[model samples]
Target: MTMDGALARIIRSAADRAAAAEPEVCDLCAAPVAEEHPHLYDTGAAEVRCVCRPCSVLFAEDGAGEGRHLLVPRRRLRLPPVDTAVLGVPVGLVFFVPRSDGTVTAQGPSPAGAMRWEVDASAWQRLTATFPQLASMAPEVEALLVNTARGPRAHWIVPIDDCFRMVALVRREWRGLSGGGRVWPAVERFFAELTERP
Candidate 1:
């Protein structure tokens, strides 16, 4: 079967199982999955799917599935200095990812939910020039997550799933206008863990 076809089947199977409230399984093989497992982003669906290590390895090449499915890379880097003020996000944290339509999307966690806005193309180009690493981001699958909420502002190139997960975290923990008392600490711990990962 074509790779995309196989991936679609796996995603469908996993979704069916999830609907039944069963344990999470590999989207490709239906094997039981660990609490923490590799994921791929479906560009068409704008969703992340859990897959077995074997399946993940299949798509690990620099470009896989011809843009249908993108294996989320584990590489994380500390971004070079760049101005966040230009993005105009009210929140201290925001993530930028490229869309299939050639536009850049800027999103961040908010008390209501994930907030999104279209980033100007010229501005995006400037960012890529300033931080050359931005040029390597896998379109539609990887994101540049920036956290300026606390001391030592940080930037990371993370999977799109990770950015959405952080959005969920903020939505769940946010309180009042300032994001409750626990939100910042939780965010710190999350980044700390990421930094510790090998």
Candidate 2:
């Protein structure tokens, strides 16, 4: 099959698997959740929690809970023109999550786990200059996800939890040295879904 056809098939298969899985519950309230739900980033714990609507709203403000819990925004922005090489990630895919300390953590998914590295401040400044949206990403709750595998490089400002979800997907599906035969297409599908999201 062609690459696009194969990616569509893989996405369908993944969705089928999701449909067959048991429902999830709110991490804080224990309320049942749909297959898709809002998330909250626990800044203190550096983790994302699946939360019910009420709990999600409670932390919607950036300062809510004294910077403890920040609601992950649903906004997904297509980044303006930029060069991926400046980011300096060895992998073609990487995500940048802002830290409270005025720095960003650059990470990518790999067979081993989420591999992280320090981002060069000058390079980051260049990117933010080109795409000002990067500077406004909700601290500790959103991230910039970049995919540079092929074609025109794409970047998306997405929720921090989404980045972690991508990392988990990679860790779960990766095989062999070059991510085996199936992992790349799965990653493609992951980004495809993000692009198609409203």
Question: TM-scores for all candidates?
Answer: 0.79, 0.82
Error of 2 at 119 (Å): 1.0
lDDT of candidate 2 over 1-198, digit per residue (tens): 999999999999889879998577899999988777898877777788899887778886656778777788888888764576787777778888877777878888888878899888778878888878888887777888988875456789898888988989999888888888788788888887875243
Segments in model 1 whose C-alpha atoms lie over 4 Å from true places: 1-23, 61-66, 196-198
TM-score attained by model 2: 0.82
Judged by lDDT against the true structure, how good is candidate 2?
0.81
**Candidate 1 clashing pairs?**
none
Report residue 88 deviation for candidate 2 (angstroms): 2.7
Worst ten in a row by lDDT for model 2:
189-198
Model 1 per-residue lDDT tens digits across residues 35-121: 878998887787788998888988888667787888887667776656867766576788999876778889978888778899888
Local distance difference test values of all predictions, in order = 0.81, 0.81
- Total clashing residue pairs per candidate? 0, 0
- The best candidate by TM-score is 2
